[model samples]
Target: MAHCKTSLAAFIFSSSTDQWLAAPSKDLSGLALDKHDLEEMSVAQHYIPKRHYAYGCFYWDWVQFGIKKLLLLDTTNMEFSTADLPPGEWSKQGIAIVEAGEGRLGMFGFHSETSSDLSYTVARNKGESPSQWQMEKTMSLDSGYKYCIRDATQRYFLFTRVEASTSLENRLVVGYFSMDIKTLQLQRVYEKQYYSQYQSYTYINFPPSLLSSRRI
Candidate 1:
């Protein structure tokens, strides 16, 4: 597994060892899928390192025409597969997946009308019905702000607010915060202090990844 390239890389993770290893080569089809195919990954865009409760990792497929799909990669056995998305949840433009709590996969989504308020859901890979998602929580932030991680035990997000006016236009404040999603409680985490008034701020959650680019 030694074929590595700047444009492409593959990482192997072992839950038992609790460590990460980069594939010696990225060209092995059985070991890794071509990175080009990731362009079609769903709204979550990139895989964020969270809890791995099973033998593989899960991903969202890009909305095609009007359909979106879930994909899972088994690093343990070197296999790839897809799962069905919870009904109507995929079409929601504002959707996020995160480590909800208790080692379960959590999903957050919003209706077409409100981008700031998101409904929470968790994926059950085992128990009575595996691979099923159940709703847990929902929240709506004040105007000009949005959530970064939805339904997580500790949720973090960014927001923008009209703070003042300069010359003939208004000024805004871009800020970040974390909260207890279940309790609807929040605390200011960070504030940008300065930003473009007319432009909207885009929030991207950059948690550490399940894999590393460096070789073992």
Candidate 2:
């Protein structure tokens, strides 16, 4: 796998092996607001660049990018397209949401890279289709990267590296731009992780081969 910004939480599941992708986000619009929704209301574009590809499995291959909307690749022709979760009205980036047993939809979790900070805004999921993008709230970082992951109940487990010494290594930094749902305030959450390795060349799996090997 490549250096992925996160796991397959946002990816849509597909059995085609060739062309499949998924992106999970808060289903707000008074329908199903997830965890990220608690922080923002307006929607804006949040680009998931190619620098954070990390360990991924299952639906991971379908993720082309996470921009103003979630993008997936059409493995049959190596083309990219949209995912099943329609981008909210005026949404920027998508946040994968899961409904907890407590009857609340919230963000499962997300991972970011060193190049950019993860931020979110809210928007309406109204109109005719799910592709309608929207924006609601924008804010700055609140909790550090250590708060990215947590249990289903929202309890968190954070692990980060303090930059005490300078070394020839690349580190993963988690930055969050907080947005208040009610007031539309924004804050930032910044933290870092280290990977003391470097890469000079990159290789992506051939879509054709990736398809043929599938049990389909």
Backbone clash numbers for all candidates listed = 5, 57
In candidate 1 the C-alpha lDDT for residue 55 amounts to: 21
Q: Rate residue 190 of model 2 by lDDT.
A: 42
Candidate 1 versus the native: TM-score? Answer: 0.48
Among these predicted structures, which one has the highest TM-score? Answer: 1
Weakest 10 consecutive residues, lDDT, candidate 1? 1-10
Q: Each model's TM-score?
A: 0.48, 0.26
Q: Write the per-residue lDDT of candidate 2 for residues 1-216, one digit (tens) a residue.
A: 122322212444566666646444322233233445323322322332322111111111112232233333333333323323423222122243222223222221223332123333222342111343233223233333222221111222122222323443544443323332223333443433445352222223447756564221
User: Where in model 2 is the C-alpha error above 4 Å?
Assistant: 1-118, 126-129, 142-216
lDDT at residue 30 of model 1 (Cα atoms)? 42
Q: lDDT of each prediction vs. the true structure? A: 0.45, 0.29
- Residue 144 shift from truth in candidate 2, angstroms: 11
What residue pairs clash in candidate 1, if any at all? 1-24, 1-25, 2-24, 2-25, 3-25
Tens-place lDDT digits, model 1, residues 104-159: 66655554433566666777664211367787776666745433332222343323
